[model samples]
Target: MFASITGADKELLSCITRLPSFFWEGNWAEEIHLTICPIPSLQDGNDLTVTRDNTGCRIEYRLPVHLFRGLGLLKEHAEEKNFFINQKMYIPEIGIMTDVSRNSVPSPEFLQSLLDRMALMGLNCLILYMEDVYEIEGEPRFGYMRGGYTREQLRSIDDYAAGYGIRIVASIQVLGHMEKVLRFPEYAGLRDSSSCLLAGSEETEQFICKMLSSIGSCLRSRQIIVGMDETHGLGEGRYRVLNGRRPPIEIYLEHLNRVHALAGRYGLNIAFYSDMLFKYGSEKHTYLDPHMQLDEKTKELIPSDAQLIYWDYYSREASLLNDMLACHRSIGPTVYAGPLLSVSSFCVQYEATWKTAGPALMAVKRQKIPMVYGCLWHDDGAECSDWLGLPGMQYYAEHAYTEGVVDPGSLDSRFLACTGLDAGWFRDAALLDEIPCINPENRWPPNPCKYILWQDPLEGLYDADIRGLSLDLHYRRTAQLLRRDLEEAGENGAFLRVPLALAEVLEIKSALSGALSWHYREHDMTALQQDAAALSELYVRVKKLRRLHREQWMSSCSPFGWSRLDLRYGGLLARLETASDRLQDYLEGRLSELPELAVPRYTLDRCGDLLGNGIWKVYDKSVSLSDG
Candidate 1:
């Protein structure tokens, strides 16, 4: 049966047999007839058919050459079911955005791994959200020391992804989120605000042109996401100082027109975040709310060729999705709905992500939107691993292609078959946020792992808020459970070391903090000595955890961003050692007092703006304990 297969069909079968699940089952040895045909524009051109007989099965895959991998997965799934079925995607473009702008840049090999995984899941597009993570000519300080991708590296990645039938699109910041670019002296004079570029400035336009030209030279895809989202102070910085105060809407539209034309010069189709248009139009300044109203003039200003992406990761309401889609339709014909993969926070919020994106995708289906993409944004220091977002990506892909055909109960099996990981483990790993002692309401944006690990040792700013639970015992039990789970994971347990190490560190810190609190209350020197000894031991463990973290980070990402974790854990270790030395000296009557440890119990609400800002501020050298 397999003798007649040749060309692309043989290639597809080879790809299928390479899957971990396929290899484990030894199914690749079975006799099968697979024929591949390329059709002209078969509605996104990714479809599969499987027919069975007494001897073996014959699979007919009709798709473009680039999408052969998607056809392979379909054939594998069909072969498992032992029945013939037709599969076609409703959403033509199933895209993913990997944000490299938020500090963590994935290495080229790891990016190839991601592309291979995306191909297995039948995804067609990959967006690298490179705000300033790519080299630009004539801009020496642009992406300086940030480990941005070089032109050759990007070209290699683009070619590698194309082999898997995935289009590598560039997501660049053309307007706002340019703080990294603005920090340099060369670009400082072109700041519209601290974070946004100076709109309507010739210098800014030239900068954007150079950036887009460099991106076009590297990436293969014609689609570009010109990011203009969350430009809160647009036209309020130097633009206001130069050209008298102008309406922000006018400034934004002028900039949009300019950038859109610039992108067109590169033969690229432009897409932008739809937040600012709705933000400046309505008094409420929201995108998902049904009450969001866009003025006719503002809507009319939108370019006919521009694609508006309505991204909402916080809303679980289907009605709001419909409303947002409706508003977007009024702006342009090409509107893409975006859902969040919930990896922006320290730990992936699986439940929240599913709840919000599931309904959002359902609404997009109801509205018959042509395209939808899931965004995995790494906001504020990409603490969460990219692999953690895989389940969410699979969820969207399944919904896009086989929502009604596939049973909800078998979703896990399909997911397991597609990606060689248990769905249960993914969900359980997200339970790091659901630890009982944490306040559910306070964990908005949900990054309990980072928050707990970074909480100041002496101040106990976040840990002190625990109401009625023993931090030491709770974290100890959690660590034990995670250790058992890691053991059961076998080969896949390497990534599990990150959360496991974090839990162990949290347990040790909790115990140390509790001991310190007791010593402070009772003025016990014996207890201080014991705690100091434990601190020394825990510091060693912290070093071990750092090693584990380094291994994990390098496995999937570049070494550039691991320094952030280094700074965090390194600071923790130094503080622990210092405190231990001071405690020992005090017990030996060498020191008078430990002023930093002489703090009273206090709970702080709204510690700082971002998630770890408060605790990080407490540890900053400039800020004294008394000031905090």
Candidate 2:
């Protein structure tokens, strides 16, 4: 179409032409006159309108460079569907947070690519949740050995994000979750406990000021997320030793007031989680509980300007959400609800995420909240890859824009068009956990594939739970199915390699489990030889899987955190070799018996839940190895 565009509207045209599907119809020879004008009262000045005429089309986009890009995506969507969207996003802020604190510090280049994808999805903001993953002046050992981003690197990322109409908000801990910073001798005095900063301490306030000063220098966004979430024993630690036996709420308010003052000095708006406020006041002590009450005294302590973020990823009840929203509104005018992508689990729970976030979004829309965002957290080691959370991100974006019910078919199409991957296949890969036949209740917190794969082979503690299932056959079939999907995936298959390799590793490991069980049960000579041979062959597959995993890790993330994967796979390989050698020696009659293999069968409470709050703990009691 022949289009005349001016101002920031020209940037929108540039972005449209860059779309991979833009050239599908050859050159645009159609006579189409397009003009994108700015609207004054657009939602947060982000409203968009597209009207078409016989001569051409006119798009009235909002001001600010970022809104231009957002409206650009809407125009592209409307053009593709052959229908104009006279819609304004109800929620003005749509953003995402990357949990760099949990591990996996994404490189600046990778983050830029992510921002490109976010623009296509119509996301307007990005938050880097860096507890200590960014360099602060005078803090040499702060992010030491963890590959934190330099000041220049963060500034470049901010500038790039601004081009796409995305604001890069800085999220840092002011009161708690300072484990990395507290480890150094210099910061040890700032500790309230291991992961929290001492409340009502001058040294702690000075440290927070330094953090704010350093972060304000690098980032361009005016909004700062001062993390005051999950300070379990806030005033019970070093604060008690210094400022004897005070109620946590008083101490918390004192610390928050100091931090809020510091943030104000830098001319920044502050936002923090509302968990601690309700947690200290309520009997239930939970975020989503509707019955939890916040006393007026504690409410009075909250800073009038500070925005309270109510984050919930597990609640499905709309009534409970409405109640939580009401509770937050009582506290402040600037309140945001944070739904989740469910990436904290070792695998993405697509259904759970949709079920929870859908109702949560609808509730927020009903209340007409000013801002809402989805979080992709890597809590506790960030074992799952970020790519796995795309489906959930897409789900949040589609729902955030439209007030009406979304069409499932159109959503899938848009996901494929924007991401170049099948939404069905992406969500289905999470089903790999089903092969282990774990109790449905226990499937969460930890993806069984990850837990089982990393379990010590010599111990095999979780093995008894899967005794009845044909694990070898199931895992092998699952691996083959994933391989077929990968082959059909074409260029997009590169992202599939990590999961595919994990499935392949599970197949060999499952087979090995069966072999080991047989040797333990029946001490026949022929069976021992067969088991030894199988272990030798499977050891090769383990090595191959390790190499594949390392390749994918290095390609997708920085080198700073690959050691976790290296140690995991490296330990698995060493154990595999040890098992193979022991079996071979016994087969050759060098030993009288494989005493470790000869274990008496005992029943395990398989029906009970195995995952304890998503963290894996090794069994306390040791398994004895007889030297027969």
lDDT string, candidate 2, 1-628, tens digits: 3345444345556654444443223334234455566677655434666666554555665634334444444434544534455556766787777787776888887787677667767678888899998887887988898888999999999987776678999899998889988988888888889999887778877878888887899988989999899988888888888878987878888888888998999888899988888887778776666567667777787888889888887677789889989888877865564545445344576655666778888888888887777787876456667777776666666766788655444677667645657887675567556444445443233355655576556556556654556766766776787788888887667767767777777776665554576665676777767767776776677677678767766776778877876776677778778877877777777867765567654424256433223334322211222232
The C-alpha TM-scores of every prediction are 0.88, 0.88
In terms of lDDT, the poorest run of 10 residues in model 2 is 617-626
lDDT of 1: 0.70
Which candidate achieves the best lDDT against the true structure? 1
Candidate 2 segments whose C-alpha is farther than 4 A from its true place: 1-35, 41-46, 51-54, 63-82, 334-346, 405-410, 434-446, 471-474, 524-534, 593-605, 608-628
* TM-score of model number 1: 0.88
Q: lDDT tens digits, residues 154-201, model 1?
A: 999998776666789888999998888888877776787879998877
Q: Candidates' lDDT values, in order?
A: 0.70, 0.69
